[model samples]
Structures are given as structure tokens and as C-alpha cells.
Target: MNSGILPAAVAGFSTGLSLIVAIGAQNAFVLRQGARRHAVLAVVGICAASDAVLIALGVAGLGAVVTAWPAALTVVGLAGGAFLTCYGVLAARRALRPAAAAGLTTQGTSAGSVRTAVLTCLALTWLNPHVYLDTVLLLGSVAADRGSLRWAFGLGAMLASLTWFTGLGYGARLLGGVLARPAAWRVLDSLVAATMLAMGIMLLARTF
Candidate 1:
């Protein structure tokens, strides 16, 4: 094992972790699902898998292809923005209609099925142009700079993503008690709504 590989992997992990730890739409969904103990494993698995593919693609030089076809991201941005906005609207409705939320939350689970969660997770991940811009373009470009160690960096980044999503999805359960309360649920959903709507709007606005 070349000593340089270790440092490159560590750097990759730090960079990947930093990129994803934010309270974006994807993380919010993961948090909400985890806190509720609803299909958490599936959600985390999807997120980690999606990121691995993207990061791998980036390292494999798909970044060049993406750069050549910038319009592709525009298409994705529009779809992602609309989906986020609609989901945000639904979250806001749940927050506003506590009575309705109570019925949904009383069962200690959201109305979403595993399929729905999976689809939403996919949409949140794949449709968002930022994922490509950051992971594919930025991370890929950075990894390329490593020359022979680009794959090592990509592996480190992939590991970081897996560890982070797994930790985030499982760790949020620590707050399950607080989030179980109606008041807390309202607050969480409200934040989710705000985050989703704002990100959605930004994506849409930027696309134009």
C-alpha cells in the first residue's frame, strides 16, 4: 500500500462527508424516516448506493460527458425542482393540519410506503442537478487531479458517503422521543417543508 493512498483516502472521506452532512432535502427525508423508524434501512441503502454510483461515475470520467451535455442537468433540475416543491407543499399541509397529521403520526409512521419513500429518495437524488455538479463535476475533477490515486480517492469518498448516511439514518433515532411529540412533529415537518421548498425554488430559478 503506497503511503500516499492513505492520505488520499482520508482526504476523500473528509471531502465527501462535508459535502453531504448539510440539511438538504435528502438528509431531511432520511432524518424524518429514521426518527419515525419507517423503512430506514431501505432509505439509507438507496442514498448510499446512489451516491456510490455517482462518485464512481465521476471518477470514471463521466464528468467529461456531463460537461459536454450541460442541458442534461437542466432537464434534471426542472424535474427535481417541481418534485421538491410539491413534496414541500405536502409537508406544509401536514404541518398546518395538525389533526390530519395526528392521524398520520399517531401510528408512529408516515403515510408513505416503502415504494413511495424509495421513489422520493430516487427523485431527490437523481433529479437534483447539484448532485451531478458537486459529486460528478467537482469531486470527479478533484479526484482526477490525484492522477493514479483517483480511484483511491473515489473509494474513500464512497465509503464516507456510506458511513455518513448509515450514521445519519440510524443516529436520528436518538431524537425519536422528541420527534414523536405532535409539537415536535409539526416543527420537523415545517422545517422539511421550508428546506424542500427553498431548495426546489433555487434549482428552478437557477435552471432558468
Candidate 2:
């Protein structure tokens, strides 16, 4: 609300949304989970909270630690790539089966258990190297330039994360009826498969 911090916060919000709007492994997973109406709140919470924590760390200058230890990101990339590949395969298989795909969207319990969903969300959030690059290095640097308003910038960025995820997770329900059809599921799953596979391959390539 302070006039001094307003511009920094606006800049932070714009930058944060620009980075987070990209199509990536985490976004794809969130879309699918949202469409399925599976642990939507938990999934959204984990994503937003994770982003907040990472952004806070960045504002606190932890990006230096990350820069010093690049190997940690490599390890995460390998694990994330493997998980994505596996998820892609499952999506592909689901797409091939009309019956399985048809039932997935309509049933509240069709998706994995809440704990499993939460774990998957966490993995997607933490394991992706790009998250660190974007949130820690890029956003951190931007926030640093804000000087006295760094926390304000970080808060604005964090607000963007929360707003985006809440909209995405809840907005997806609008497609519930449409996704209930087998053809719709097939299309969605196929897209998911392709997105996951491409992202996984890219991550793996970076690791090697």
C-alpha cells in the first residue's frame, strides 16, 4: 500500500506472472490434476507454498548458494526427468484405453490418493531445475534491485503464484463435464503424454 513500494511490487507481479505462465512440467501436471478434480486444494497449496518459500530464499540471497552448487540441480534434473518419463508413459497408456480415460475425469477418486498427489506435486515443484533458475536466480536478482522494497517485490511475486494456481486449479472444474467424455479424455491424455515426454527429454538432455 505504501507509495514507495508500489512500483516494485507491480514490477515483481508482472515478472513473476511472465515466468510462471510458461508451459512446463509443473503446469502440465497441475492442469491435469485440476481437470481431474483430484486433491485440487492440496495440489494448489503445495505449488503456491513452494513458490513462496523459494522466492523468499531468493530474496534472502540464497541464490548464491545455488550458484555455488550446480551439481544439486543436476541431481534433481535426473530424478525429475525419470519421473516425467514414467508419468508420460502412463498418460499415453491411458489415452490408448477409451474406457479408462472415460472414467478418469468424472470420478472424484479416479486420480491417485491425496498423499500421492501431494508428493507428486512436491516432486514436480522441487525437482525441476528451471524453477530454481527462474525463482532464485532471475527473480532474486530482480528483487535485489528493489533494495528497501525487496520484500515487497517478493510478496507481490508470491501473490502472483497464489492467484495463478488458485485460478488454474479451480478454473479447471469448468471442463469437468466436457472432459467426462472418452474422446475428450483421449485428447487431453495425448496432449499430456506429449508435453511430459518433451519436457522429460529436455531435462535429461540437460543432465548429460
**Per-model TM values vs. the true structure:** 0.95, 0.95
In model 2, residue pairs whose N, Cα or C atoms come closer than 3 Å (at least 3 residues apart or on different chains), thus clashing, are none
How would you encode candidate 2's per-residue C-alpha lDDT over 1-208 as one tens digit per residue?
Answer: 6797888888888888898987777887888899998899999999999999999999998889888988998999999999888988998999999999877755655345777889989988998888999999889999999998999999999999999989888898899888868999899889889988898888999899
Best by lDDT: 1
Where is the poorest 10-residue window by lDDT in model 2? 103-112
lDDT (10s digit) by residue, model 1, range 1-208: 7989998999899989989999999999998888777788999999999999999999998988888988888999899999999999999998998776655444544456777888888888898898998999899999999999998999999999999999989998899667766788888889999999999999899999
> What is candidate 2's CA lDDT for residue 6?
82
Question: What's the distance in Å from true for residue 81, model 1?
Answer: 0.6
Residue 167 lDDT (model 2): 88
Model 2 ranges with Cα > 4 A deviation? 108-112
